[model samples]
Target: MKLSVWTYEGPPHVGAMRVATAMNGLHYVLHAPQGDTYADLLFTMIERRNHRPPVTYTTFQARDLGSDTAKLFRDACQAAYERFKPQAMIVGASCTAELIQDDPGGLGAALGLPIPVIPLELPSYQRKENFGADETFLQIVRTLAKPTDRSARVSCNLIGPTALGFRHRDDITEITALLNDMGVEVNVTAPYGATPADITRLGAAHFNVLMYPETGESACRWMERTLDQPYTRTIPIGVGATKDFVEEVAALTGCIPRLDTDRLRLPWYSASVDSTYLTGKRVFIFGDGTHVATATRIAREEMGFEVVGIGCFNREMARPIRALAKDIGVEALISDDYLEVEGRISNLAPELILGTQMERHIGKRLGIPCAVISAPVHVQDFPARYSPQMGVEGANVIFDTWVHPLVMGLEEHLLHMFREDPEFNDAAGPSHHAHGAKQVSDAPDPIGAQIIWLDEAERELRKVPFFVRGKARRNTEAFAEARGDSQISVETLYEAKAHYAR
Candidate 1:
């Protein structure tokens, strides 16, 4: 039971690449295929940028497989240095490159390169996009974290910012602002414009704020041992968590906690007024372990929803989810297979689903409303709005995202009519209307959504000459048929290499 071949927030390497690039003065040389250059889309498409990604690729092909691949990797690295002249460089690989081990870090070490080179191993085989970003940031900090000015005691580091949950630029702004308000000068904020020197100052920070849990553990521990700066385990995901995060930092550095009480008030007000309007909302959750666990707590404790089922594809973070399932008295459906996840959807019989984008297809087929609360996202998730599911602001966002789609006034209107029209209720045999996927009476129902990128690509290729188009179409159909809406399992995705090798 494993999940494989799923869409992520961006190219798997993009998250880590963002961190390495954002640093004021840093560069990253990624060992990957030439096609992996698709990472630039994140900045252009999602972040809406004009610059290129700060990465270099070895880009070995089948022809070069037997030719000194390691040397090819080193040459790429040297070329990157000659072009970028980066003071610090990160040596890393992506999913495909990981399959073929070319140790760039060792080469850099032996070469005695003038600039600092940090090794990064975020193999997509065993982890998701978030893990890569988080781990990449941690490795950078670990390689450079050192105390500065023994008497300079203003110590704190901000970690986690790849633009999934609370990884938004606004979040970085809010957090850095809050930390400054607390009198704790942040030594470095991982992946949020942190350079090699800034990373080295990580040890100077007395603590690390793990904004997201998927990554940053390594640097936190390293700083703990070297700088004796204890990192806080509190992640500011929800309203209470954000306040607590602030209070904890205040307590540590002896600064007053700032509270935008207005942010807290609305959720409480909304819960009091409309939660009952939306109570017993049968729901199911699935995705990564961090989201599954915390959202379970929020749904049960705060939102008053009956969480019918829950699971995740990330085993590293699954124990907590398993415990949550037991607490909610539901058998946790833990599998990565699309078919298995789809099958599990049956037992839950939920009105709504909060999972990855794959679940969107399940919800669409099953006629259940779905909100993508976790990763494996498509381009759709990258809205122009600052949407982070971490912190008090995030709680409000969740409330809106989950509630608005389900509480269609039209459904209530239809139900009211069903209750009033006694004849209509009595003659309810087969209806012309689509069952679960309710649409407004006066509006035309929209057609199924095509995966925008794929559909557009197909259309573009079809415009080519007949011979080229024919072959392209055939290959496209073949690849689609091979994948064929195949469900993935947590194990299959997390353990891709292990399974592939075995």
Candidate 2:
């Protein structure tokens, strides 16, 4: 409602669209105005789907409002059913249409189409995207899911992979392999590759694997009460969590967990000598609650990074994220305002950021390296190759995603540190062009005083890895200036490192 250049989540109806588009043989008819059709771009352009989303907009214009807009909605609905002939249809009003009180659900029912017509009473003003997706999925399940006999072998409905989600396609692939290894069959992966028929057979599954609580929790809870099916709580995104999820599923399915580690490399890689530079590196995390919590564990436990700050934009997830932040000895930020998030990142000045696309922008502006861990992402996040954020392969993808930025950041820092050195300065040009490049002179220092480094100290500094030499030089200079010493020696450098370690 408060018009902004960017938003973490779209209007609730957009969420409804996500659910409708994610499934097969399901369509959404939205009673919206002309401009409301723009939601299609989110799917077509960003997600790069081969086909347009399964949505129909009753694009009522300003002129149509004066003359019976309800009739327009009815006409649109009849046309959508005739054209798509979906097995099920979800009808709702966009924020603009909600003002006119067209009552899409009631109108949709009156038409009496052949297939089941599920009505969505989405409060566009009161709720946002994730809530809308949850409510829509829940309504569909209530209307379609039938009581049935459970499968002979233990099976689960993989709940909550939706359209426009961050890496849902690949995550499913990685997770399915993990489940198969434990001898559990996936009954169906819903709202992503499912149909109305799949929804009816949901009760056939022994249990449910609730992948994303934001969109699937409500429906899973309802099934728990109505169908006597329980769902898994842990999401398998990291090494530890994946292990926990494997054990949890094993208990539910009575299958012995394979507990395989042959494909996992993060555990040993992070502990290796090459990764020592990652230890205690300051990091800030912000995204949806699921990813924020997952990234926090990976950063602190697996990667050995210090979590300088942590937060999420989904206010519904505030309580748990707050609890997480408390356990981590930091204040939890539960807000949707990107400006406020940017300001906090500025204050924290973390060396690295793990967050959404919005925070990716913030990190760039602040000169901090970032890796996207959640949604509200752009087209680039949807890679052409496999890049999941779950299971062992996901852990591998994450390791590459998070560490590359930090390593490149170190390279940039080293570049700045040696800017005055003729051999490495801007004037040096490319290695291939070095013969034709012009030589450059060092600029005079604008600051009156400078701490000189002794020959022995400079040699000792050179012995440090080039990637970290800049940080060492700066720390030594700071230590010298703090003690009123005009020069830095080997002793000063060692003492400064020891002081910082303490």
Candidate 3:
């Protein structure tokens, strides 16, 4: 594999960990080397999971390569099953271990384990994390899910919503509430809080709600094809999309779509006079395909922002992302390279950025405001507050998350305009903070004689706000100097304004 300091997605095994981690009564036995154990910290630290992931690593060292590594994997699998007593287990090889070609699947199958043993044949060199999650979930469903009697009431399985997803937990809560309000029952939420038994009960649902397409699409397609259960396509992230999702569910379950938008303040706040300035603010978006597509619609339609550029790192989503980008009059950036994404962002110089945690760093380095809209996020993105990115409550969260960066930037600009003030100097700290203040020097007096302004010119300059008078004065003097005038007049001041306006 090509060496890079950072990657947008990890090897396929990490994706397998995501699926295994999201579920209950399911264990993943990974035939890996010693260093491969680092995936544990990702869940415990980044996702802030209270417990370690449900995984057992063979953790064979360099010395063990000369020995029977296959025996080590078998022992680990047996130990995992005995220790965890899971209802189901999956076995796979990490990227480095794949080179040994121990055949983890075949080796796992040889073991006469009482529980269901599903072997995963994931090509580490070819596929990425999302694909691994999708494949793993699909395998589990294929092995466990069976056709059963449908529920008396209309119900659906909430497919997707795995661990490490950005706000998946909160999104599930919001969507579940929305479905309950619509008189629909949720059969089972899979992959996150599901068990092997839940997979079997999936056939009981009348339909499926596919929340995340990247990790759940394959599994949903299988259920739809095999179990005769249809699934919803519309993801309820924004006001418009949520409405469409409601209507889609209504059609599926014969429940009337609740068009009550009275709880939504995004439309009203967006159209308010105070937010008019936010209109036409250019934005660059990059994330997973699903989030990028949904964020584009919200950015352009809901928030009145101009989408200058849009793309995703997930190649599986390239076609739809490209189609959406074409509709918006821009090329879809479908590369995993952050450097290329940085170059594109630099060329576009958007006023705002809505993307993943990687793009958050890119924005900070470029001094652009950003909001996290997708996965691969840091621990900070997993806040203690109830922040959902779907349904009515989710719409409110989106409004705050997207708008705060711009408003905070404006606040910083205002503070900088008054930086020379004794109370507002850099050393003085923010007025809202409780830090101690320090004295800061103002600009020293001019060394040489400067252009003088007439009484009318000075009065006209005062018409500009005090905070920006220095800029007006400087521009007026420069204009007078360029014209070879000895003093600045009212005409020169107005002329400078016109020159700058152009």
Candidate 4:
């Protein structure tokens, strides 16, 4: 509802469109004004989808406000059904359309269409995109899924993936491959490359795999409760997570997963001497709940990075994020304001940032390397190459994606060793310096020169790597000030480091 240059999520209707677009033979009838059609560009331009989203917008202008907007909505629904011949249809209104008070769901129901019409009553002012998608997907499953006493097979349904998700296509492929390797058949993948028939037959699966927690959790919980079916909560985004996911699936469906550990290169890569520099590298992570939580674990446990800060724009999932942060001994940042995220990033001054496109921009401005791990992404994040954020292959992709921006351990060591050499520190500066250093250096000081540093402490601070020296200096000064010290000394710096280490 708050107007800004940037937002973490789109409107509720847009989430409905994502669900409709991801499924086959399913159409979305959005009661919206002309400008609202811009959601189509997200799929076409960013996802590079060949076909336009199966969405029919009323596109009523201000002039039509005086007219019968209800009739306009009915006509739009009828036209969408006739043209698309969809097996199922979802009806909803955009934020502006919601103010007009036109009952889109009621109108669609009155249309008397041959196909099933799922009415979406999403409160645009109260909810956002992920919530809408979750509701829409849940409604579709609830309406289509029928209770049956059919015996379960060695199969599962992958739930919660939709259009515009972060690398969802590749993630689905990777997960499908892994399931195949485990000799488990995928019965259906709802709201993403699934059909109306697939949704109706969801109960045939032995269990459900919750891929993205944001959109799939509700549906999985409903299915589990109503149908007495179990689900795996493990998100296979990292090496450890993938292994855990496989084990969880095995436990749920009693299908022994034959995982090829050799295919998962992240474990070996992280243990290699070349990746030694990655160890203890400070990282700031902010994104949706699933990616932020998974990335925090991967960065800390697998890639050997210290999660200096972690957060998510998805406030509904804040509790889990806060718990994860507490376990890591860091406070969780739960906010929608990009400025707050930017402020935290500046304060933390992490070496690498794993988040959305907005974080990428923040990292760029801060001369920090970043990898896109969540949605509200940019076109660059949707690479032509297959890069998934799930399964064994996904762990490998994450390792490369996050590590590519950082200097190798050997390279970093060489730079530090020859830093004082004239050839190494030429007038043009070292080759290892970030290209955006000028902009980053021009950033306003996060904390002013309030705390004085003694000459000995300043000299000791310079011994730290330049990339982390600023954070080290700030931490030491803050520690001294907290203990009522007027000035920071070499002993204070060591004390701060030791305190932080514990």
Model 3 vs. true fold: TM = 0.87
Candidate 3: tens digits of C-alpha lDDT, residues 1-502: 7877668899889999999999999999999998999877999899999989999999999999899999999999999988999999999999999999999888888998998999998999999999999999999999999999999998999999999988999999989989998888999998999999889999999999999999999999999999999999999999999999999999988998875677799999998998887898889999999999999999999999999999999898999999999999998999989889988986676778899888887776655678999988999999888999999999999999999888876675577667778767654433432343220111111311377778897666644543234446666677777888877789888998999889
| TM-scores, one per candidate | 0.75, 0.87, 0.87, 0.88
- Model 2, span 307-367: residue lDDT tens: 9889998877899999999999998889899999998886666778899999887765555
**Cα TM-score of candidate 2:** 0.87
- lDDT-superior candidate, 1 or 4: 4
Q: Model 3: which ten-residue window has the lowest total lDDT? A: 439-448
Better of 1 and 3 by TM-score: 3
Best by lDDT: 3
Model 2: how far residue 256 lies from native, Å: 0.5
The better candidate by lDDT, 2 or 3, is 3
The per-model lDDT (C-alpha) reads 0.65, 0.86, 0.87, 0.84
Once fitted onto the true fold, the runs of candidate 2 whose alpha carbons sit more than 4 angstroms away are 421-502
**Count of clashing pairs, candidate 2:** 0
Q: Could you tell me how far off, in angstroms, the CA of residue 292 lies in candidate 3 after the best superposition?
A: 0.5
| Model 4 poorest 10 in a row by lDDT | 436-445
lDDT (tens digit, per residue) of candidate 4 on 91-159: 989998999888888888998999999999998888889999999999999989976554455888899
